[model samples]
Target: MFVLWDADGNEIRDEYPPVDPLDILRNPENAAFNLDTIIGRLKELGGSDIVALHQLAQNHYIVLDASTKDGRHYIVRIARNSVTSSTSARISNIRSYVRIALDFFRINAPDGIGSISSFKSTANARSGEPILGPYILPSGLHTPSNVFESIEEYFRWLISVKKTSTTVGTTKPDLDEAQVTLKKLENLISESVSGYRYDAELLRGVPSHQDFSGHNVFINGEGLITSVIDWEFHMVKPAVLAADYPAWIRYNGTADPRFVDKTSQFSSYWMAGPLDAKRLRQEYDAVVKKEDPEYHRALKAGTFCRMAEEWLLSDVVDIGCRRMKAWLENSLE
Candidate 1:
C-alpha cells in the first residue's frame, strides 16, 4: 500500500494518508515522500539503468537494482515515509561518525570485519555541496546522529528520550513491566558508571554494528562476507557495549533452532579463514578484561542499558520492550 513500481521500473510512492510535514520535521522517523524524487537524486549520484524493483519488506522499503552504462550494478533502496525525515546537520554528523567507526574497524580487523560498501550521499558525491530536498542516502540507509560527546552524554539522552516517549497500553502488562525494569536498570547504570569515561587501552572505542544479523549481511560462494549492509544503527561504543557476539548467536530461547543453525553456518563461513565465533568472543573478552578487571559487571550493565535505549527509540515498542525485559532478566546475571 505504500509504494508501487511501473513497467518502466520507475517508483511511485503513495502518501495518500497525507502525513504532516511538521511531524516529519519534528521527528524524521515520521518521514514519507515521493520515491521518484529520490530516484532522480540517485541518478544525480551516479545510478542509472533501472532494471527491477524488488520489495524487501512490504510497506517498508523496496530495492531497485540498476546498472551504470559501464555495467556496474547498484542497489537503490527506497524507504516508506515512516523511516527518516531529518535533513539536517545531525544526520550528517551521524554519517561521519559511522564512517569513522567502520573505517577504524576495517583498519584494526581487516580479516574479521566483513566487506561493506561506503555510502555515497548526494552531498558527499557532489563534493560536500548542499543539495535540495530531503537528504538522500545511498541504498536508503537512515543515519541520524543526536551528537553525544561521551557515554555519559549518551546516557542522559537515553533517559530523556525514554521518559518522554514511553506510553502505557491498556492490554500490555508485559510492556508496563518492561518499562519499570528498564528504569531500574538505567538507574543502576547511572549510579555505577556515571562520569566514568570508558578509556580501556584494549577496548575504549571499538566499532559496533549494533544491528549485525544475517538479514543485514550478504555472503558469497566461498563463505566469506561479500557485503555488510544496513549501517543505520552503527556506532563507536565501549568494548563492553560493542564487543558482544551478533544477536543471532545469543539465542533468546524463542528463536527457531533450524534458522539459528543456518545463520550460524553463514556466520562461520563469513569469518572462517580469519576467525571463528569462539576465538572472536575470546579475543573480545580478553581485551575487555585487560581494559578492566571488572569488565563482566560493565558488560552486564552496558548490555542492559543499550537494550533499554533500543526499546525506547524503536517504533515497535511491544517487541522492543519485550526484548528489553527478556535481556534484562536473562543476560544481567
Candidate 2:
C-alpha cells in the first residue's frame, strides 16, 4: 500500500489487502498505515506526478510510476518492511550485491544486461519510521541474459562445492525419501561422468540472478532490453549452476505461448526458435564444452544436482518438485 502523486500534485492512493484470508486473520494490524511513511517520503523527494501505481503480488511491493516536479519520470519500488534493523539486513546486503553486479554487467556486458538507477533509503519525516526502499529504477522493457557463458563457469564451481560441502544447511524434516532418491541419482551421475574435475578459481564470485525470467525482464522499442527488476534473489553462484537458462524457459510446458513469444523476442541470444528443452540443453552442452572439453559429463551431472537441490530446498510440494523428480529418474535410466 502506498500513495503516488502526479506532476500536478494530484494524489493517487493504492491499498491492496492480502489475497489470503488467513494472512489478514494472522495479522489484523498489518492493514493500517502501511503507506504513510512512503507517501511522506514521496512528497519530500518531489515525486508528484502519478503515471501508474500497482501492487506486485509476488513480493508484495508497491510499484509506483510517477514524475518529479522537473518532469523526470521514475519507477519507485516501496516494500512494506523497514530496512534499518538487523532483522532485515539480508535484504540490504542482497541489494548491495545486485548493485555491484549490475555495475559490472553494464561495463562488461552492456548489450546483455539492463541498467538500474542509484538506490536511496530514508525514513518517514513525520514518524521517523524506516521503509525498505523507495529505490528508483529506470522504467523500460528489457531481456534476460540468455547467453549462458556469462554464468556457466560459476555454476560448475557451485555444483562441485555443493557435492563436497560439509556445512550444507540443515536437512529438511520430510526429505528422507527425497534424500534417498537424490543419493541414487548422485551415484549414477558419479559413474557416468567420470574424470570430471571442478576448478574453484575460474571466474569465482560471479553474480547470478537466480530468479531470472520474463516476469522480471522488459524489452524496449528497439527490441533491446532496457531494464531487469526484482533483485531480491540475486546471488554469487558458480558458473556451472548459474549458467542454466531461466527456469521459465527451460520448463515452459504449461506456460502461455504469448509469454514465450514475448521472452523470445528479446532473448535473441538463446531463443532463436520455439522453446524446446532438448535443443536448449544441447545448446548449453555446446557452451559447456567450449568452456571445458571434458565438461559434457559434468554438465549433465551438474544439471541434475541443481534440480535435486531445488527439490530439496523448496518448502511447498508443487509441480516443480514432481518435474524435477521425473527428470532426475529419467536421466539416470
Candidate 3:
C-alpha cells in the first residue's frame, strides 16, 4: 500500500509491522465512525469556535454537525473547496477526487518526491507563469521539475524557491539574507547526520502525514481521539525529516535556549500550554526511555534532523530560516 526507502533512495522492506492500512481499519471502533464516546477520554483539546471557522475557511474541511431523527450524533465533513452552488465547481472537485483516488491506488516504490497529478500551477492564466506540477508546497513554493533527491538538495531548492519562484527571482536584501541563513542551517543539519550511525535512519524514507494538527483531530466529550481528519497532503520522506510533534502538543518548540533541541528536556508529547508542554516533553522521555529505548535513542539523535524538517515545512521560508540559524548556532556548536 505504501513504499519505503533508505538513505540511498533504494526500495526497502516495511519491517515495522508491515505498512498495511487494513490493520488500522480492522479495529472495530475506528471501523465505526461513532464519534460520541472514544474521544471523550481526552481531557483538553478544542476551545475556540471561531478558530474552527477559520479552519473551515482555509481550503480545508467544512464540518457540518448533523443529527438523525433518533438523536444519533454525527459530524459530516467535506472539503471546503468541494462545497459549491454551481454545477461547474462541484464537477471540478469531483474530478479532483477522482485524481486523488487514482493516485492513491497507483502507489509503488517512488524514488523522487511530488504528486503525480498534473494541475495548473496558478489558478489564473493571466499570471503567465509556466504551469507547474503538484510539487508546489502548501506554502506556495514550487519544487523543481526534477524532484528533490535528498534533504540537502531540498534545502537548497527551498531557499531558491522563495527567491526565484516568481517570473523574476527576487534579489531583495532580506530574501538574500534568508537564503544565507538557510544555507548555514542546512549545513548544520548535514553535519549532524554526515557519517553518523543513524544517518541512514535519519534519511530513511517512509509515508508520512503532512499536517497532524489539533483541528483535524476530533474527540468526543471524553478524551479518546475518536477520529483524525484531513489527510489530503501526504508525503514520502525521511523519518527525521518527517519528525514533528503535532500542533496540539506544540509549544514555543523550545522556550529555553539551553537544550539545543536536546532530550535533556525530555517529556511526553501532548498537551496545551508551555508549562504543560515542558513537563510532558520530559515525562515522555522517562517513559520512552524505559518502555521504548530504541525510539528514545532515535529521538535523541534526531534533534537536528527534526528541526531541519520543521524549517522546510514552515509556513514562510524567510522567517523559518532566520529562526533556525539563531537556534542551531548555539545548539550545534
Candidate 4:
C-alpha cells in the first residue's frame, strides 16, 4: 500500500497501483509528460495511490495529487554531488534494489508492509518480479515474513566494495585485518549452519524491500508503526533479515565501530535516528515469539553470528566481528 503524509505529518493510506513504469516512459505522450497523465494511467489500470511523494533518500520523495484515486504519484529520489556517469549507475542501482526488496518483502518479511509492484517490459531490463509473493491485493502485495538474506547480501556487497567512487575509504584503515575478518566470516557462514533453510520460514517468501531503516519507517502518535517507504533500495533476499530488523534498529545503543563509520559516510544519509532500537527489538521479539517461539531462537543462533561476521568483514569493524573474536579468544580462558 502507498502512504501519503502532508506537511503536518498527517498520513493517508490507500491502495497501490500495479502499473508498469516503463510503459509511461515508452509513450511519454500517453503520460503527457505530467502528473495527471500518470495518475490517469494508474487508474486506467487497477491501481490506487498510497502516499503523496515526500523527500527521501539523498534528495527525493514521491509526489501525489488529490485528484487521483489514492492521491499518489511516482517515487522521486535525488542525489548530491552526482555526475552523469554515476547518476545512471545510482538510479540503476536503486531500481535493482527495488526489485530485490519487493521479492524480500513478498517472500520473507511479515505481513502489512509495502506492496510489490510489477515492472514494465518496456522499462529497464533489470526490473522484473522474481515472485508476486504470498498474497497479491488489488492495491498491493504483502510480505509473508519479516527478515530475509537479500539484506545480508546487500551488506556483504557494500562491505566488499570498499569504494564505490574514487573518494570512498580515503582515510587510513587496517586493510589486512578487514580481509582476514571477511574470510573468517565467510567460512563460518558456509560451515556453521546446517543449511540456510531456517530463514525460509522467516522471510517474506517472495522478495522485499531492503532499505527498512529508521527513517523509511514511520510511527503514529500512539507509537504504532504506520508505514515504511522508499522502494529504491528494495531487493530480493532471504526473509530472516526482515524478521530481525526491529532488533537491530532498537538495540543499536552500541553498534560496531565499523558500522558507525560506514553509516556516517554513506547509508545513514537518509536514516532516521529517533527510533527506539531496544523497545522495537522487544516488540519484534514478542510478536515473533507469539507466532513461533522456536523461530525467534533460530534467528539468534547461527544467523546472528553469520550476520556479525558479514558485518565485521563487511566495512571493517562490526559488533559480530568483535564479539566473535572475544568469544573465540576467551574460550580458552
Candidate 5:
C-alpha cells in the first residue's frame, strides 16, 4: 500500500513530481534575484494576464494569481533566496531535484540527507532524518552531508559529544552532573533496544514537514490536496523525529496538543495558526487512525523518542536534565 501525505491525500514521489500545480523560484547568483525571473518562468508555464497578488509573508516569497489564455486559474509562489554556489559542478546537480519529497525516499531513490540545493542525485537528504551534527556546527552538506551513514554511528557520536560538552564547561560543576545524566539516558535506550526491540522501529527514515499545519494545506472542493507548500524545512528524518501531522501536535517531542482559535470574520486561512485548528487536529487524527494506523502510533511515541535529543542538546541544564529524567521513566514503562 502507498503511504499517503495526509492519510488519504495524494502520493508525492521524489522521482516523478507533478508540476505547479506548484512552482519554485530560483536565482543562481548568491546575490538576491528579482521578480523578472519569476515572471519569465510564469509565461513559460502558459500563464498570462498575470496578476501579482499582495505579498503574503514578509521576506519569504511573492504569491501570484494568474490565468491561462484558456480560462484556467493558477496560484504561483515565487520564493526568494534559493541556494546556489560558486562551484559549477554543484550547480549542475541541483538543477534537477524533485519539486517535493513527501516521503523518506523509499520509492526507488537513495536516502536524501543533505541541503535541498546541495549537489546530489536528489534533494531529500537533510541529515538522515535525525539531528546529525553537534548543535554548534555551522555548515551543511559536504558532498551531500558529511555525517554518519547509519543509526549506530549517531549513537556513538552523541556519546562522544558528552565529553566535548563537558570540556566546554571546564570549571562548571554542572557539567559533571550533566555527563552522568546523558550516560544514564543513553544506557536506558540501550537496555530498551536490547529487550523490547525499540530501535528496530527506527531503522529507517520517515517524512517530516517543517510547518505541518492547517495553513500549509491547499485542497480543492472535493478535498484532494492541490499542493503542500513550505518544503523549505520539510525533511525525511530518523523515525524518532518523524512528523506526519501538524507540528504543534507533538512539537519538539513535547507531545502536547496545542491550538488557538484565531479565526477572524475574513477567512479561516488568514490567521496566525488558523481558527478552529484544534478541532481540525482531532479530526485529522481520526482520519489517520482509519487510513494510516502505524503513523498514529508514532504520533504518540515520537515525542518521547525525539525529546531525548531536544532536551539534551537544545535546553538548559537545570530544566532539560530534570525533565529528561522524568521523560525516561515514562518511556521505560
Candidate 6:
C-alpha cells in the first residue's frame, strides 16, 4: 500500500495494494466515493463542512467544503503523483521539467514568452532554505507577486542561469537527447523571438509547477478545483508551456497500453487539445530546423538520424536496467 503523511506524523491518506488509479478499481472500497468519510476527516483536519467530491476536467478532482459560520464551500483537490522506482527517475524528472518548460513556452507564450509566477523561492528547512517556487492552489491562497512581477523577476534570474557549459548550437552529449535537441534548436530562440531560446533568459518566464499532469490535478463534483497541492516537484517555466505538460507522461512509459489503461480509468477527460497540439509541434519543428539547418536539411532528404538517435538512448537505458533488475531477482531466487 502507498501512504501519504502530513508533517505532523499523522497519515493523511492511504491506498491499499498501492497502484496507479488505472491499475486497480474493481475493489469496491477503492472505487467507492467515500465522500462522507473523506469529508468527515477533512473537517477534523480544520476544514469547514464537506459538500461533495467531484471530478473536474482532465484527471483533476475537486472537494467542496463549507465553512460552518458562512456556509461557503471551499474547494480542495486531490491529485496523483506518478513516479515508480526506476533507474532514470531523476532524468525522467528533469526531462519532465524540460517538457513542461517547452510546453509552457508554446501555450502561454504563443506570441512570444510567458512566465509562471514566482514565490519567495525558499522554505524554512534546516538543511538550508528549501526552494519554494510559486503556484496557485485550489485552497485560494495568494502569492505576494502578481504574474507581471513574477515574470520580470524570472527574466532577471534567467540572465544568470544561461546554460554556459555549451553554446546553443553545440551538442551537449553529457545531457539527455532532449537537452541536446534543445541545444541544437537555439538559433530559433531570440530575445524578441516568439519561441523558446537556448539561453538562460529563454527559460525565465515559466509559471510555477510545470508538471500539471492530469494525475496531479483533481476537480470536485461542482467543477471547482479544490487543491493544486503537489509543489515539491514544481518547475519555473512560462505559464503557457504547461498547457500540454500532461503529454510528458507518454515519454515516461505512459505510452504503454497498461499505463494508458490505468490513466483512462481515472481520467476520461484526458485528451489532447487540438490548438495546442498544432502549435506545440509547429514550435518544435521551427526550433529544430532553425538551430540545425544542416540537420534539418538532411532530414528533408530522409537522411537525418541524430534526432532518432537522441530519442532511443532512454529506451536502451530502461531496457538495460529492467534486465539487470530481473537478473538480480532471479539470482537471489
How do the predictions measure up, each by TM-score? 0.42, 0.37, 0.50, 0.41, 0.44, 0.27
Highest-scoring model, lDDT: 3
- TM match of model 2 to true structure: 0.37
Error of 1 at 67 (Å): 27
Local accuracy of candidate 5 as per-residue lDDT tens digits, 75-168:
4443332222233322221211111222342322224332233333336664342333221222231122344455445555655555455322
lDDT by residue for model 2 over 109-196, one digit each (tens)?
A: 1111112222234464433322221112223311233322333322333344333332223345324444454466456545433434
What order do candidates take by TM-score, descending? 3, 5, 1, 4, 2, 6
The alpha-carbon RMSD values of the candidates against the true structure, listed in the order shown, are 16.4, 18.2, 17.6, 16.9, 16.3, 17.3
Residue pair clashes in candidate 5 = 112-124, 112-125, 113-125, 113-126, 114-125, 114-126, 129-237, 129-238
Instruction: Please report, in order, the local distance difference test score of every candidate based on alpha carbons.
Output: 0.42, 0.38, 0.43, 0.38, 0.40, 0.33
Q: Whole-model lDDT for model 1 versus the true structure?
A: 0.42
Off by over 4 Å in 6: 1-206, 239-333
Query: What is candidate 4's CA lDDT for residue 314?
Result: 31
Q: In every candidate, how many clashes are there?
A: 3, 25, 20, 64, 8, 28
1-333 per-residue lDDT for model 3 (tens digits): 222222122222221121112322223343222332212211112221111111111212233232233334333332211123343433333333223322322333244454334433556663332221235455354545765667667666655554443322245665566667667766766677773555554565444556555444554333334455756676665555444333443453333333223222122122345654454456555554565454456556766666565555544323334555566566655
Best-fitting candidate, measured by TM-score? 3
Worst lDDT window (10 residues) for model 4? 76-85
